[model samples]
Target: MLIDTHVHLNVQAFDEDRHEVIQRARENGISHMINVGFNRETIPSSIALAEQYDFIYSTVGWHPTDAKDMTPDDLEWIESLCRHEKVVAIGEIGLDYYWDTSPKDVQARVFREQIRLARKLGMPIVIHNRDAHHDVVQILREEKAAEVGGVMHCYSGSWETAKMCLDMNFYISFGGPVTFKNAKQPKEVLEKVPLDRLLIETDAPYLAPHPYRGKRNESSYVRLVAETAAQIKGISLEELAGITSRNAISIFGIK
Candidate 1:
């Protein structure tokens, strides 16, 4: 069965037909999904979604863009949420220089605190780095994030960056952008990244793959990502799906 390593089902985009979307994904062979909480407000909502769905799990932490609003109490709240039964990781966190919503220093501080939290709780992480590769890699190393290895969600970095993350025992996740016709870098990274170090996601209601690009994404569309990787790695689609699913189970400790 396939697993979407990162999704945002808690967002309002799926409110209208969330149940049907999930059912369709199950029918399409998606057995599990990891819903990521992006900020202080989304954590409870994300956890709620996980509790409601047997196959859904969640990750809680502030996204880089939302880091500006985080406070001491917010960190404590997130720490508390990490103790929830269905919360498996601390993330959708990291650096995003592409947007100026949060100051760089604030994002780094929040990112480091969350990394420490994940380590303290013995949970993995879900990183979101955008155009801040150097600092992100440096911070992860300095923070000893390898202790709570995680996935670099929607990875859009170079092979060198991916190799560094892999060396730190982190899984490299590819999303819808990998399927775009002009996505040369991700395609190269997909080919170079060892299958064992790979995970696939849709980041639903966000980046839908080609043909489905510009439309709302869903877990079922993860098949397109698997197909893309298969073509790049010269493997069968079934083999790609099986390996990626196994990798997800291994990383997230999902049953």
Candidate 2:
């Protein structure tokens, strides 16, 4: 079975057919999906989705874009969620300089706080870095996030940078970008990832892979990602699914 390590089924983009989308993913062999909560608006729905679907899990944290509005109360609330049986990790948190919505300092502070929270809770994290790879990796090291480890969700970096992240106790996760025709970075980095450290995700409702690029994405599309990763690694699709699913299980602590 395949595991979609990242998704956004809680977003309004799937409000009308969330159940249908989930059903289709199951039909297509997606065994588990970690629906991510990026901001205040999405967290409740993300938790609800995990409660509603047995195969669904949740990751809660502040997105870097939402860093400007973060408050101590939000951190406490997120911490409270660690007790939830379905709460797998602390994140979708990190740096996102491409948007520039929040000051870099604010983003780093919030990211480090969540990293500490995850480490305290003895939970792994899910990271999001876009055009801020250097700062993200540095902060992870400075904050000692290696204590809990984590996945670099939808990783967009060079093999060298990925090596740095991996060395700093992070798994390199690839998503739709790996299937894009012009995604030379991910394509090249995929081979560099240790087979056991590699993970796959669809990041549904965003970054849909080829043939469905620009279209709303869903968990079922993870098959395309696994297929592409298999080709890049010269392994069978089943092998890719087994390896990535195992990686996801290891990170998320799925039983």
Candidate 3:
């Protein structure tokens, strides 16, 4: 069985055939999927999807791009959702300097607040680091994020940055990008990440892997990622699947 450690099936991209897409994932051997909801609109939809599917789980958090829009009420809402059995973590939260939709300071503060919330609730986080790797690692360090740990969602940073995250007790997650031929850094990093701390994902409707690159992505495509990861790790596909699925389950506290 395979588990998609991170996905965005809750978003509008799958509104036309979300169930069909999920079924495809199941048929493709995806035993479970973690649907990440980063903001107000997606969070409830994510939880609803989780409640409907026994194999699906949800994570609640605010995206850095929308940092300017988040208020105290939103933070409270995320905290309340943490009590939901289907909500496994607080995340998809972190610095996104690429978009810069929100000011740097605002993003940093909001990121810190959610990290503190995750720490308080004793839940792992799902980080989204973009061009702000330095600031993201710095803030994570200052906030002592190691106490709770997390997954660096769709990690695109260098091995140096990834090593820092690993040191902070975070798992390094790879997605469709790792399947690309020119994705040298991610492949190299994936090779170096310990099997127990390594995870694979599709980041559906976003980073579609090669052969499906530039096309809309779905969870079913995670098999391609697993195959590439297995090849990179020099293990059988089944072994890689088992290893990554266990890593996802362990980090997310999946029951």
Q: Which candidate leads in TM-score?
A: 3
For each candidate in turn, the TM-score is: 0.98, 0.98, 0.99
Write the number of the candidate with greater lDDT, choosing between 2 and 3. Answer: 3
CA RMSD per model (angstroms): 0.8, 0.8, 0.6
Candidate 3 lDDT for residue 168: 99
Q: For model 1, which pairs clash?
A: none
Task: State each model's CA lDDT, in order.
Answer: 0.92, 0.92, 0.94
- lDDT score, candidate 1: 0.92
Lowest summed lDDT over 10 consecutive residues: which window, candidate 3?
Answer: 92-101
For model 2, the superposed segments whose C-alpha errors exceed 4 Å read none
lDDT of model number 2: 0.92
Could you give candidate 1's per-residue lDDT for residues 101-199 as a string of tens digits? 999999999999999998898989999999999999999999999998999999999999999999988999999999999999999999999989889
Top candidate when judged by lDDT against the true structure = 3
Residue 176 of model 2: what lDDT? 91
- TM-score of predicted model 2? 0.98
**Model 1 stretches astray by more than 4 angstroms:** none
